[model samples]
Target: MSLGGKISKDSALEPRIAAIDLFCGVGGLTRGLERAGIDVKLGVDIDSACEYPYLANNDAAFLLKSVADLEVVDLTSKLSGAEYTLLAGCAPCQPFSTYQQKSGPTDERWHLLGHFERLAGELNPDFITMENVPNLARQSVFTKFVTELEALNFHVTYGVVNCAEFGVPQQRQRLVLLASKLGPIALLRTKTKRKTVRQAIGGLPPIEAGEAYDSDPLHQASELSNLNKRRIRASVPGGTWRDWNQELVAECHKRETGKTYPGVYGRMEWDQPAPTMTTQYFGFGNGRFGHPEQDRAISLREGAILQSFPKSYKFVRKGDPIYCKTIGRLIGNAVPVKLAEAIGKSIVAHVASHSGPRKRQLNDWHD
Candidate 1:
């Protein structure tokens, strides 16, 4: 049957596919997919912390369950009666990250990909997508995933995508895969200009270290130590600790091995895209998370903004403390929303191409 006939008459009137997001941390992928006209039915994640933001930002149910515990029956219930269904699983990438190269293969998170593969085999939805660090592409697990999908008669296409190229204001690279049972599918090449850090968060009002913006709770920075404050004051934008005075240099950096890790404890350049944000992005001592002009580390909200999350995306409620560690983990672990939007658009285009006259009729109905 064609893609259009899979829907009920009620759903055909709307003519959009339904999606279920796995590992849907804070609804980044759901938000983007919805923006591309897909109806996101539910978001699943193990962390109870994700419930607030995921439900706050998207019109979807949040299921606090690990992927291992999720049953196909539960997903099918939510996705039932849709024109087509999409399954998105962006498994955590720490196990395959470049920083974890030495210990990554041994990390338990390595098996999560295998779990996702098994789930996909069981469900076999109309379309599937996954996003992860580019380092995942080099692993044997990645090849096995592609082979399994093809074995299921899926037309698969995957590539390492640069987030900046899709309008994200961070220089993050991720492996993105899109597979379809309907027809051949590939990610659309967006010709938009790359976004810079200044364009993303330049307009926010200033706040000091250890201070929260009076207007927005998430716009708060972690407190820096007295010595770190002095180190930041001496540091230049785009420059590392190597530029700091001898007194401010960490003893670790004084060693020859540490000299090669220059990206640490550095301020981001205003005109450039930011370095990839990590779970520790709120700390001044981690990566190049320091503010360009401000003498504090990038605030929690700044990191979220860099991740392409809306400034109004609420992660905490009033009366709750906006701890740096909690909010930082949510932002850093999210898929860049803009990149997800691009993937959504690509899927829409692919389905439309295969739908032929039904798609044209739907377009005319909308117009």
Candidate 2:
């Protein structure tokens, strides 16, 4: 029943788990699950933008289709003979994001989770996992989702997990939920200390404005407009708009109303974890995105690395113009790979405790 292949007797505690990553942007979840010893059979996403990276980086087959149009049968087809099936999905959370809190349910992408619920009911995989912005846990639809899983007699564990505590370098917090039909379920243990920005990005080679680093695809920076280039020059590390000169300030910033909220137009401090990464992380005007010392925004590769993807994580082809809109959506929309790995490890521990042991040593299963 082992996935990929049978586990050796010494590593017998390993479970033969097969997983499907829904809304699998660039296979972050799939990569993490694989790292935690789960076999990722396929990844499903509506955005063809995810197809290249998803396929190039992992063994999972990438299905470029909207979750709304997916059927339980289609998903099952990918795991026809596998045992211990696990269905994992992280619906697009922009609608539930803090930035969109004022927009309410008016955001159209909010309904994508319903598709996950529907497929879960039909396929009835042994385990289910989902991750989203913490704000989602407070929504009525999220409440209903929990209630439905409870009614199905599944043992469910849901909570907001700080990504930094799980070794992700950024201070991103996500609501992670796990439900299992087999006995009880829970999350993995958090690392005792959180990781910081310097510890994570300190080792990468430095790059100049509007440039990419050698030997790293994820370290490329965004193109700067003439006006933004000038604005960024005035921004200081961990400091906000107050650092800008009056003439260079935007009209919006000049208004007394803009004086009240000052988290924008700031630079990240090297000693602390970086501000929560947003879609515009490559744009200096967005959040505390300026390099700690350099007068430029964090590069695309740095943002991706902070999100816990490998240095080689492919976003666009090597020669492409690095479409900001496309890469931003991919980065901002991803479930940080480190967080996903933690969730996967938790599930593996849960299944191992309930399912039994093998012939090989437990540590051997780590690979």
Candidate 3:
């Protein structure tokens, strides 16, 4: 059965357009799209850990299935009655991430994009979007995916977008693709003012490492080893382990290769956007996650805020012990919500322009 079909005119007259988010980790993209007036009907992810946050934050159903195992029929069934459908599949990006050891084509995750391409071809949704590490733009997989979308008669546009340019308080660059059968579409222009680390999370009540804030559980930082604590005490904001006294240096940093990773064990500058948060961002030793003046690594909430999640975004239920690793992975892996909002707005504008007065008439009828 074809994926595209109309819901009742009464439903179409509503203000929001509709989308389904594939590989929708914790519903970051879905949340942003909803904020920009798109109804994200469903989110699919392989990790069950995503279910809580995904459902808690967005008005959507969560499917705990790998994209490779997902049937177009299943997706079509869920999305069968939407007036305009957007299929967004931002497959696992670890294979293309610069921080990862280059696994090349051998990585199984590399093939997940092919699955996304296949589903897009089968569903032939009105619009398509994908986001990944900017390095993916240089890979053959990205080229093949774009070519396949074009072959399906999609007008595709893609570029590397800097999240800091779009109000995310982190220096993350991502490859964003927007394809539509309706007509040409592109990302909205960058915002004039960039958000800084101070602007994003500077107001949070302070908590020591290993301690959860009394009111906010996610604002807890991971505890440091005594040695690591000493190292952080000496580390300057934006300065690496090189600034440490010889006694405080990790033995690894004395090696040639380790010296090159100068961003590690570094403090964030209060006035600047934070460095890209990796899966291990809860640890002080990972990347530049240290707080500018707090003498502790950034808390889980801080990382989530940097990812542009609302300060109140819930990742875990009350009374549950917040595991740093689990929460860190969720926060670090999320698409910056602001970036997704920009994408959502662009899609909405494209549809509004293409649909023209018919959509306006529908709105008038509803009014």
Candidate 4:
């Protein structure tokens, strides 16, 4: 209910750079933007579950509405008092990710990016950015979105970038797009620090499978099946499923078709980055989410840490019970905080390089 930033008269005259995070799940992108020195004034998402975390960790207003339902007038007041505005988000990915089937369920999420495009076209903010699964770059909607931005005179650039290279301690790759009405804008390929799984979560105290550490509520691991318990014990760090005994091999892996899937039921290597953190990352069978030395799947907090979220980042209010399924989805779907921070830094540097006198700022906002 609290809109963190008030639209004051004097500040309105010299408005700061403000951003609205559309489809902002748990404030990942908003936090990163704030860290990169941008004032993200608002975050909007449809999920009621995301409200607590989004508001708790961010100094921004939370709007629990789908981007499809938004209009220019709806955002006029909310996005007020910004001399330079940015609209940033990663629309839901199930509709476009490789993990999701191309056909079946129908939902508004499929066209969420289209709605985002509509807002961008209508609001005409100074800058815009979107992050999503790499496959999204191959879709027609993405093509049309970029084409329309170019038509609107935006200097647009987009491509798939490896998240590990950008400071995230996971082997996740994502497509990133940056468009600016000012001048040419591109993601800064700075070759920053690359983190390993050990550097990120190695220091946390060991917790057994199905055990929740009271010291950190989010540091709870999911219960492994009796058979999975034995499977994980036999697993060596960075080893594949083939390392398991003949009786321990899954039924699917026995088939010729499933032989290629050596990535599952594996432990992470202490010196290397982890596999991509999926929504079911807390389940050992879901992916190579098992602990490097422990016998359990990586905990929810560990997954968040691999995604570059700080250890102290709050996902639920104190005294609130934790649900791994919902929290995992929020963490998996979130943009890596480090990647978002890099994107924000790129934009801020781009804008700072072209900044002119305060008197000409408003008039020079556009190309």
Candidate 5:
């Protein structure tokens, strides 16, 4: 057999599995599934920002289209001939995110999940999964979502999981729901000790203010405003506005309302897990965005690491636009690859136990 033919034949008998990543921003979830032995066949997203990272890092095709415009038949064409189809996605959660709360059915973003439900109804995939901000569980939309899955006769498990517990190295909590027509499904094994920031980023090459890493573009920091640079100098690691000298503080920060939100403009402590990374993580005034000990803000790469992407995972193509906003959106929007990988492994384990023992080894397949 030709080399290509041999591999293709080998793959078919090797417990072949395939997944479609919906809202596959930068393919973080897909990256995790690939780590857990599932082939990511394709990805779909509304933003062009996701195309390069999703396609370049994972060997998958990217469809730059909104889920709202598409339907189950569209997915059928994409899958074409795959044996096992896993419908997986995370609806954009900004409308329901704790960071920005604007609820009710009138919120247009809530309808996207309904679109996801529409696919589940028509495709009836063997497996389905989704992740979102933890508060989603409390919303009526979430209740409706659960109702739809159960009505379709799929066994479902949903919970709020701390991503840090799964070695994400960031203080982020998300709602994860896994549903299966096969049988009962659960999340990846619960995490034990949480991984810390030092464990995740301490070993990276150190960079000074306004400098990028020689080896990694993501590790470079944006140039600081001269006044902000001085303010940062007075800031202590793990300290908030209380650490700033009176003269160094921003006038807006001196206001009464600003005093209540001290976590903003604070530096991370080297030994702790980082606070949740936001879309504005590249900006100094957003959240506890300062680097743990570095005088400058955290680099795009640092944000990626906090989101649990592997160091080798490439976000931008060789000649693609390198705007910070684009990079930030990709990193901020990803479901941490580590968390996704864990979930994938858990799903596989559940599948394995229910099904008869296979002839081929599964761990090697995953590895």
Candidate 6:
């Protein structure tokens, strides 16, 4: 399947693969799956904020409900007319992420995966898939989820996949899982080139620090502090804080522990994929978010594009103020749209070849 262009439709004779995107933050996965010709019936997420973007860019219903509260009937009702069902999601991955290891299963959100597993068991969809931080593979809940799918006789394949290899312009690593009762399913790689930061955002018009482009508010970059401006000036593409003049470095960097942290206040390289986009990507001190040649950090629009969202993708109404925290979290936590599209295409191919009487039996769960 192709990336970064118009949505492509599969032949009409294929079994119609309809889906429900649980934890569909900002609709990244939904948009990608739609591009690969999946009929996403509705997206279920607890964030009321996700509603606008989820409904805006994708032709699907947005249900503002926790996955824990989503009864099987809710998804079945939405997917009733579907010929084949695909239950797809990425439960919020904080508890399992390396960056936030202190948050364990005691964190209420950790059980969201368990809820997903429960729903998967009850729904028995023809296919199931999830995207999450790669660290999730080490957790017991993941083990249980996989074992249960195997118990259901679903063929499952999962592993850590580099986002750049799948056309996302960021070097984000995610654990992707695919389960199908149709046959031995796998996440075959796309026939595409590794994407780079330059390919993703090189076409955008330039803007100064704190300047919102005249016509595009999402293109606005955060204003840098006077000190940060000087620091960025001293930085080179893909270089670390060590490149800055000694006086330009922060006292924190002088600390023994901070000496090991080279990614902070760094610049992204134009020829390579960018460091993973974080919630603070708009701030110059937050990781290597600096625009490769530009003096400012990447704009919100640029970050979204790196996540493989089309430049025209809408996050809010035209007059709305772009709240960085909310939108950043939405983009940072999203399953890269390009990766989702690749997975969707793989699923479509597997179904086209492997679908048989077993697919009909699994669809019986919807009745």
- The best candidate by TM-score is 6
Candidate 2 residue 310 Cα shift, in angstroms, is 0.6
TM-score to native of every candidate shown: 0.92, 0.89, 0.92, 0.92, 0.89, 0.95
- Which pairs of residues clash in candidate 1, taking residues 3 or more apart in a chain or in different chains? none
Please write out the lDDT profile of model 2 over residues 1-367, one tens digit for every residue.
Answer: 2221222323222567878899898877887888788888889998888888888777778888988999876777676655577899899888888787675566667788888888788777778999999999989989888888887778988999778888888888899999997878888775457777788787778787778776765677777788887877777777777777878778887888878757777778877777788888888777778888776788887888788878767777777666876787788778888888888888888887785633233222122
- Local distance difference test values of all predictions, in order: 0.85, 0.79, 0.84, 0.85, 0.79, 0.87
Q: Estimate, for each residue in 169-240, the C-alpha lDDT of model 3 and write its tens digit.
A: 999989999999888999989545888999999999988888888888899998889998898999998888
Candidate 1 lDDT over 268-299, as tens digits, reads: 99999999989999998989999999999999
When 1 and 2 are scored with lDDT, the better candidate is 1
Which candidate ranks first by lDDT, i.e. highest?
Answer: 6
TM-score, prediction 4:
0.92
**Regions of candidate 3 where Cα sits further than 4 Å from its true position:** 1-16, 357-367
Reference-based lDDT, residue 185, model 5:
87
Question: Which sections of candidate 6 miss by over 4 Å?
Answer: 1-13, 355-363
What tens-digit string does per-residue lDDT give for candidate 5 at 262-317? 88777888888899988888877787888878788888888888898877667776
Native-vs-model 2 lDDT? Answer: 0.79
lDDT of 4 by residue, 1-367 (tens): 2222222323221235678899999988988887777788778898999999888777788988878888766665665656678889999988887777653227557788889888888777888999999988888888999998898789999989999988999999899999998899999988667799999999998999999898898999999899999999999999988998999999999999999889899999999989999899999998898999999999999999999988878899888999999999999999998999899888888887786513224333332
Ten residues in a row with the worst lDDT in model 6? 4-13
Point out the higher-scoring one by lDDT: 3 or 4. Answer: 4
- Give the Å shift of residue 197 in candidate 1: 1.3
- The C-alpha stretches of model 4 lying farther than 4 A from their native spots are 1-15, 104-107, 357-367
Shift in Å, residue 68, candidate 1:
1.0
Candidate 6 per-residue C-alpha lDDT over 198-234 given as tens digits, one digit per residue, 9 for 90 to 100:
9889989999999999787889899999999999999
Q: Between candidates 1 and 6, name the one with more favorable lDDT.
A: 6
